[model samples]
Each structure stands twice: as C-alpha cells, then as structure tokens.
Target: MVRYFDAELETMPWTDVLAWQAERTATFVRGLVDRSPFHTEKLAGVGVPTGVVRDLAFLEDLPFTTKAEVRESQSTRDPALPLGRHQAVPRGAIHQVLSSSGTTGQPVLYGLTATDVEMWADVIATAFWTAGVRPDDIAGHLVGLPGVAGGLPYADGFRRIGAGLAWIGGWPTERVVELMISLGVDAVLATSSFGTYLTDRCEDLVGIPAKDIGVRKMLGGGEPGLGQPEIRQKIVEGWGLDVLSEIMGLGDVLACLWAECEDGGGMHFCGQRAVAVELVDPATGEPRAWEEGVRGEAVYTTFAREATPALRYRSRDHVLVTATSCACGRTSPRIRCVGRTDDMLIYKGMNVFPSSLRDVVLQGFADDVQPSIRVWKDGSDQVRFDGPIPMDVEASDDLAPDRYREVAAAIAADVRARLQVRVAVTVVAPGSMPRTAYKTPLVHVRETDDDQ
Candidate 1:
C-alpha cells in the first residue's frame, strides 16, 4: 500500500511542522498586509502588530474570518477584482476559479493561481495516499464536475499518484455501472450517500451484488455519515469494500484537507504545509487544547496561497480531535467531524447535534430501520424546540407493521437515554423516506414561510 505521498514532510516531527508552518504564515501575512485590502482592513481594525507574524500564537489575536465576510467581500467586490477583496493578486494571476456547493445560502467563489493549483494537487494526493490509494488502481470518479472544488481539482490529485481515472459522473446509473465493469475500476471516489446508493444501483443494473462487481475500495466524503457506525457498516457490507475511508474538506479553505488513513481510526490532517488548523470552542470561540477526545470547531488559516488566502478562517466545522499520533507514522493530528455549528440545536439547556441523534437511532435500531432518517422542523430557522423534537425514520423492508410500536418506543427510549434529549419518533413505511445520490440532509424543514 502507498504510505506517505511525501515521506520526508508527511513523517516530519509535529514540532518541526509547526515551526515550518509558522515561518510560512509569517511571510504570507506580511504579503497579505501589503496586497489584500480585506486582510489589511480587518487586521487594522483589530490593531494587529505591524510586521510579520512570528509565531502561531499570534493567530489568536487576529480576527476570525467568517463565511459572511467572504460572501460580502464577493458581493461588494471591485469590478477589477472579481474573486473578492480577498483576491490578493490580479485577475490575470488566477488560473482557475472554484465554488462551494451553496447548499446553505449563496455560493462563495475562490480563486486559484497556477501555483495554487499545483499545490492543491499535492495536498489532495497526500490525502488519497493516506487513504491507501496506489498508483495502479483505477478509480471511478462519481462526483459531478462543475465549478465546484471537488471537480477537476480532485481528479487531478488522484491522477498525480499514477492512478487511472474514469470521469463517469453525471452519466446514467446503468452507464456508470457499465464503465465500472469495462474499465476494471477497483476503487470509487464519491460522496458517502452516493456511494451507498450506488451499491443498490449497481446490483439492480447488473443483477448481482455490488461486491461481485470487482470494486474493492471506496473513498467517501462530502458528508459525515460514513463515520457513523451504522452507516459505515452499510457501505462496507453493500460494497464489500476492503478499503473504506472518508475524506473531508472546506471549499473556502482547501479540498480534501483531512483524510482517513488505512489504519482506520480517523482522518489525519493532510494540508499541514498549506493550512494551519486550530481547535476552538464553538460556543465561546476560545482556543481549545489539541488533546485526544477534545471536541471543538476547526479553524483554518491558509498560507502559501497566492490568489486568495484566508487568515484565521472560521470554518465552523466542528470536529473531535481523535489522536495526536497515529500508527501510520504521520505526525499531524487526527480528527472526525461531528457536525457543524450551524447545524447544532439547543434543547432544554443542552446542545444537540442531529447527526448524533441519527447515530443513536441507527446504532440502536439498525435492524428495524432502513438507515434513512430526518429530524422534522416546524420552521426553517427553528433551533430551540420546547417539545420532543420530531423525527421521521423509515422502516426497513423486512420490518413488520406490528413491531413498529416496539421499535419506535425502543428508539425513543434509547435516544433519550443516550443523548439526554427527547425525540418523538414517527416510523414510516419502507421506501417512504427520500434517499439521495448526493449529500443527505439530516434535518427536514416541515414548514417554511413560503409554504405557509
């Protein structure tokens, strides 16, 4: 198996990596102060010391860059600088422009210079390499290619390892399955939900189990369910995958920034040279210690980026630091994304995450339920629920109607017992709930102002 993409750097001491990143950040900050008006004004407002940032600790005093600020920067961008005020270089310097999925609100655009593109390839390749991808493997690329970061950037990174790539996204399901067979594709790159959905799709199309299709590996990302025990079991069993790993990235930062290693614990930080990561309390925004089992929001600052670099970017990606060291010999930390701060809810003086609730149900009642669930919301902006939070769960195909009450009661009890949150379980018939070939929504807004 491919171990480290760049062994010397990947296996470097954690202390040395920080020192290297600190110096790079210092130089980048000095350049940003001169070039980026956005960074300059923000830094000036906070009264940051005038000069190069000499250490990583200097980041704490810097103002956090939010998604709102980025959107505003883009919307109010000068005509000459279309990529936003964060655009440190001229438009001509940007060789490519990528965008976010915009599932939350308006999509944000990011610019990449020629150097940024080459660095991105190396970063993404390191992620894939950590996930056990080898040079000879033929990977079926299933994610849709558009203006999004996961498009050509990811494909280019995968090919950097001398792996064969089949761009089969946006094609019909049957056609995709056919190419997988003909091209001898042994690995698949896809969103977690899409990977699970394709397992059933391939079986239906070929009249055989997906495991028999010669695909032995799955690299799932774009969502968090793969880390859940129930979801992981489903994808592993359905695909008969020998190597199942999850990758995570932020569009505003870098693509495939964290990747799971073959040792199978959590994703290791893969963008160390390009990005500095910090753990901060989501509630207070205070810096959290990088100890194992500590949960906090992941904050990122991009250095060595030419076109658009973010300093102390508030990623809002809440994660659990899994380990400070790994058996894979990489010195960077490991993490598992629990949920986003935006997706978190407040209940009866306790903070709750919908993904955690789903994990409770799927882990406790995996046999009776289909692996599909959604928390029902009375309004789009609803966060605090006075009553038992409404949730809908789809029954598995073999689950009987008579056992619905038993299963539902057990699920409610288990959720309350485990998460200390009350949930009103509404078990629906099999196939009633929606399943997607993309990122799955954990919360379903039942009432919107427009609908009302």
Candidate 2:
C-alpha cells in the first residue's frame, strides 16, 4: 500500500502486483460498504456478500453499478448525514468542492479533502512520468473551469515535475496563438483535435511556425480522438514534436490517469492508485475477450480512490485492452479507447461508430474545416447517423445550394464503398452551430426551438 505511487508497479512482476491488489481488495471493499451509505445500499441490492471478496473471480460476485445508479444516488441521497455518528470525516474536514457538468440535468456535487487532492496530484504525476513527461518542459493549459476537473491536476502534474506552465484557460483560437508565441510554450494540455487544429492554423497567425512554436506534449480527455492512431500521428508530426502522449482521466474518478506511449497500443493506466481495468460485454455483463483487436466496455475499479471509490465502474467507452507486456517494457495494463457505447449505432444493419466514421472523414477534410455529427431517431429503437461533413467546405463552397446535396451524395458514396450503409450529410456554415466557450458540441442538427 505504501508503494502505491512507486514507478516500479509498471514493471512489477505480474505475481507481485496481483498479490498486492488481492491483499488490498478485501480491506478496501470493507471500507466502502461500512462507511458510504450509497455503496452499502448498492452492495446489498446487488447481492455483494457482507464478507470480504478475496479473489478476482469474486469480483463478478459483486453487482455492477451503472452510471444511472450513481446519478440516482446523487439525486436522492444526501451524502453529508453520515449515519449519525460513524462519519468518514466531520463536515468541516472537506477542503474543496467540485460540481458535475449539469448539461444533462442538475449538477452532482462532491467534497475533496486535502489528502485526496495530494493523492490525485501524486498519482497523475507518476502517470505523466510513465509517458516520458519531464520536469524540464514548459506547459500550456486549455482546461476550461475549476469545477470541470480538466486542467488543475494536469498542471499539478507538470508542477510536480518542476515544469513551468502558461495557464491559458480554454480561449479563442486567436488568443491561444498570441500566447503561444508570446510565452514560447513547449507542451500543451489540451484536446488532441484542438491541438491539431492549432498546429495546422498557428503558422499564419502566431508568426512562429506551428512546428517551431515549441509545443510538444499533449494531455487531454473528455473525447476519444486522442486514442485514434492516425489522428494522433498527424497531430504529433504536424507539430514536429516527438512525444504525443494521451492520458485517460475522469472528473468524478481521478485515479484512472493512464498515458499512451509511443507504441500506441493501449495506455498504461495509473496503478499508483488501485485501478483495476476490466474489459466486459456491456449487455451480458460477461467478461469480454481482452485480445489485441477485440473491443469491449472498460470497467475500471479503484481502491485508492478515497474521496469517491468506484467498483466495477463502467466508463461507457468501448476500448481494446491488452494485458500483454509492451515492447516498450512497461507492463501496466493498457487500453485503446475505440468509441463510446452510446455513440455507436446499428443503422440499416451496419454496425457504425461516430468515431469510426470521424477518423476517416477528419483525415479526408481540408485543414480549416470542422466536422459535425447528427443522429436521427428511427422507430424508437434505432438511431441513424448523418454528417461527417466539414462546415465550410460543404456550406460555403462555390456550389452554393448544391452544397448539401453534393455532401449527402459524397457521404452516401463513401458509405456505400466503405461502410455499406448510406447516411445523409448536411453541412452548416462555419460557426453556424454554436457551442459554449469551453466545450465542443460534436452532435448537432437542424432542430427548431419547438422541437425541444
């Protein structure tokens, strides 16, 4: 337990890591069911025995907690009451508070103690180190807000390495370029797409060539583009950078910060905290084959997550998990996040993923154009996809009114040839659809105000 953050975990003999995990699993399980009412009720409902679950096979003995279950707990449960006397901490012990996005509905709030934040910073720093993140570099941040959990711990990772950073919170493209040149930023903590876009566009606006702007490192989450190999390579080469590492993280669960190495197989998740990566079939809850090519839902578990522990936590992401040792020598379990289960659709008998179509379309489009996606409901059980068209190319081209038709035709042709399903494509004018300053909206369609 004391060696949790030690880098040796990455290279530890399989025998040792498993033994350590098994030893801690029982104690960790006891703490959750004993203290947190949320988990107590959940564990009981799911038929988790009151006794310790000692074996990895017994992990299946516990019922899985879905996102809906967590949301329901947040909605109905008051976390502060603490069983009258046996509280984990006195109410005033909380050092910080964070809120969920609330885009879907009401925001869920959480309290983080000082110890939790330290553990967060330390574990993630180790993750950055595993990906060859160094203390000598300078970093630029594109994180949006305090509550979003995007940037602070990332910056904290850099800071732990004794690196300096330009805290340029998510801003306009023009502002980012201006600061990049002014500050001579070397590394970026941003979305892979935005990082690529800035690299492609910075030469003209920043005075410094995008490749020479000194930007090298990229750390991002909240999207799947970082896991795309071709897109990852394009971003790295486009910037003339050697390192294009992608770290997987979650706001609610901070301990899953894993970094993708140059091999690009799957990211080595942070074991500094007790994160267990389980690949499973979303429907049957049966374990999926964790081979190189097969994809499955990423079920992540962590005992070291003291603030909010998640057991058998389903990430909603479909990923490729390879437990095999990497050629690069790191032995930590790694995952290639393929796509979100929610984002995949079976349309006209074609198994389609927005990310799958996205990786192809973004590769084909010109530099300045942005892509969009729309899913139309079909007969209550189906969701058909539309558009991977670049905004300006399809909407502002010389063809004018012929633009949308041309785009739809072109997409249908591509789909027929590659995907075998014809999808309608509609392109909006550049910036015709809007997004909040901090976030990018990938799915948008022509919907009337009355449609809501």
Candidate 3:
C-alpha cells in the first residue's frame, strides 16, 4: 500500500484545499501588513485596502517579490532588522538563519522562528516520506553544506521521519565512501550530480561499484537534471537503485516543496500547507491553471511562515505539469522542472536549455561519448548564440582519439535533428571536463589567457 506522511492533507479534495489556502492566506497577509515594512508598502502601492489583502483573489494584484528586491532590502543594513525590511518578526524571535547558494547573485539570508523551524522540518519530512524514505532505513546524507536549507534542516527532517541519519557531506569523497560502506548505508540523500559522481568514485576508490555498497534508494535534489531521462538512467544503473525519486525546492520558499512518489512520472506538490503555489506566465505575469501539459513559472506565497513571509514570490523555475492525478492517490498536481529562466539560451529565436542538449547527447550517443558535457559561452552574460553553439563532450573509454571527429559530427547532427538547434560539438578526451561533488553547471565561459 502507498503511504503518506499526512494523508489528510495529501489526499484532500482540490476544492477543499482552495478554501483552506484562501483562509490561511488572508490571515497571513494581515500579519504581513502589520509587521513587514517592505510588504506593507508594496501592497499599498498596488492599492490593496489598508495595505492588507483580505483574500487569495488579491494575490494577482500584489506585486511580485524578486530576488533583487530581497537582496536590496537586506542591503539597507537597518540595525533594528538584520533579516531585512521584509522580516515579519523581531530579530530576537528568529531561531535560525539559512542562505541561498547565490549562484545567480549575492546569497540572500532567510530567517526562521522556532515554530517556523518545526514547520519546515515537518514539510521536509513529508516530502522525504513521499519520496519513499522508510523509517527503518539508514539514510546517508550528502547535502550538509553549512547554513543552507539542504544541510541541517534536511538532516532534522530525516530524523523526524525516524530514519537513521549519517550527516556525511562536506567531507572528502573518499571519506564519504568509507563511512557509507562501514555504516552499511542503504539510502542516500544528495545533489543529482553527486549521485553520479559517487558512482564513479566508489569503483575507483574501493574497487567496488556503488551498487555493491548496499544503497537501494536515492533521493536527488538541490539542482535540476535529476528528472532528465539520460541522467536518471545513469544514476539508476550506476547505483543499482531500487527506487530513484526527485525532490525540488527553493530557499526563498519552503526547502522541500515537491517530491516524486514511487509511481513517479513527476514530483507532486508537497508544501500545500506552508506555501500557496501558483503557475504563471514568466513573461506576462498572468496566472495559469493547474492542468496537465500546462507550462509556466512557479510563484509561491509563504502564508504560514512567521519569521519571514513572502507575498507572491516569483520563482524563476520553469516547469511542465505532467499529471493531475496519480495512482499513488495524491490529489495535488505533479510537475517536472524544465529549466530555469536564467539558464535558458535563445538560438535563432528558438529557446533551449543546456540540460536538454545534454540529454540528447547522452541518450543518442551513449556509446561514443561520456555522460559529461560543457557548453562554452562567449561571455558570462551571453544568453543568445547567433551561430552554432560551442560545446565540448568527453569521449567514451572505448572510443579512440582518431574517431573523435566522426563522433562529434554524429552528435552535432543528432542535436540538430532532435532539438532543432545547432550545436558546435567538440569531443574531448575522457576526464578533460570538470566535475563537482555539488551542482554541476552545464555552461562554461571562455577564459582569457590573461585571466588564466
């Protein structure tokens, strides 16, 4: 039988959820207007009555909260408010603080009250349970970066679910492997790339493939690409996993919001109580309905938060709704994150994500190339490539150096035929490209000799 962390909320009727969210949002907005200076002014500027919203209908009227705005608010350095002008509670009430990875810009700090911390733990536990983490399993965590939500907050969530936890991240890979084997870790929590990286490292270090290390389950998060078919196939085969589920969240909102169930076509909405989620056109800021095949950016309102309450926060993540109903009995919609808006590239008016190109190369040319690739950019800010985009792919171990040109030609042709976009493919030697234990970036800016 399929199990849920909270069956009542997970299987609630969609119409009933709408009513619950509306009521919670109204009360949450009133508190935000009274306590948060940034939100109060923003809501008033949009002509919300008394600078407070009374219902979910006003969500569209409320201005979006952007990362730039949040960063600017904190830049003020007001002595009274360390968390920023948007902080909904006093500094003393903040029980803990976490930060973003700052991949796009400066790392933004988030505050959580004691109660908020408990709520986040529950949210993450619920997500993990949905992803098939059982209480009896010993989960070896590889997401222990300091002060990030993926670090301690996730560890707490693991324990809350009554699972055996070993916080093994931030250590050297050799040490991580040693401990996993010694402790007989059967389940793993890691970034998607790390899962693939560990597969290779295990064989190289211990002369044993990761599959032999006894790990039967893997939950990948903290980055995209885990849901891609090629990546998923690699990880599942590499680790010999019984189940592989993808979990996604943003630091600006709840840490673990969407999780894939065992029936998994995509990750179901798992943060309904803490966040009121909306799908909207990224360009037009217009709301989109939650229907299968619908594509849009995700926007979140943290209506149940205390330390910091986000009002209509715009998350630049672009996703496609894959299913409206699951055999697993989840009533919420399921989604697969397509790509981030900032990571999108335009080639001759056609939009392309680097992850998509990676998928085509790995899936179509698996024998000729390694699973790694890097897209070369003209500059750091270049998003539009006028010519065939420059990309480097590593050759497979069995592929000879002299045959690189043939493989390159085949890959370029395949990418063009599949994605309908031109890519300049250069097959490099195996291990020539960089790999990371954390998130792996697909794009690399050309470095000048002077900089080198």
Residue-by-residue lDDT tens digits, candidate 2, 114-135: 7877777777777776665666
lDDT, model 3, position 53:
37
| Clash list (residue pairs), candidate 1 | none
| Runs of candidate 3 exceeding 4 Å displacement | 45-57, 400-403
Screening candidate 3 with a backbone cut-off below 3 angstroms (N, C-alpha, C), the clashing residue pairs are none
Compute the lDDT of residue 223 as modeled in candidate 3.
75
lDDT of 1 at 283: 75
Best by lDDT: 3
Each prediction's RMSD over C-alphas, in Å, is 2.0, 5.0, 2.2
TM-score ranking, best first: 1, 3, 2
What are the per-residue Cα lDDT tens digits for candidate 1 across 46-131?
64445554468777887888999989999874888998888899888989999988977899999999999898999999998888
Query: What tens digits encode model 3's per-residue C-alpha lDDT throughout 23-117?
Result: 77877776676788888888774554344433466678778998889988888888779989988898999999999988998899999999999
Give lDDT per model, in order: 0.85, 0.62, 0.87
Those runs of model 2 whose alpha carbons end farther than 4 Å from true positions after fitting are 1-5, 45-54, 77-89, 103-105, 203-208, 348-351, 360-420, 426-439, 449-452
Residue 206 displacement (Å), model 1: 3.8
**Residue 90's lDDT in candidate 2:** 51
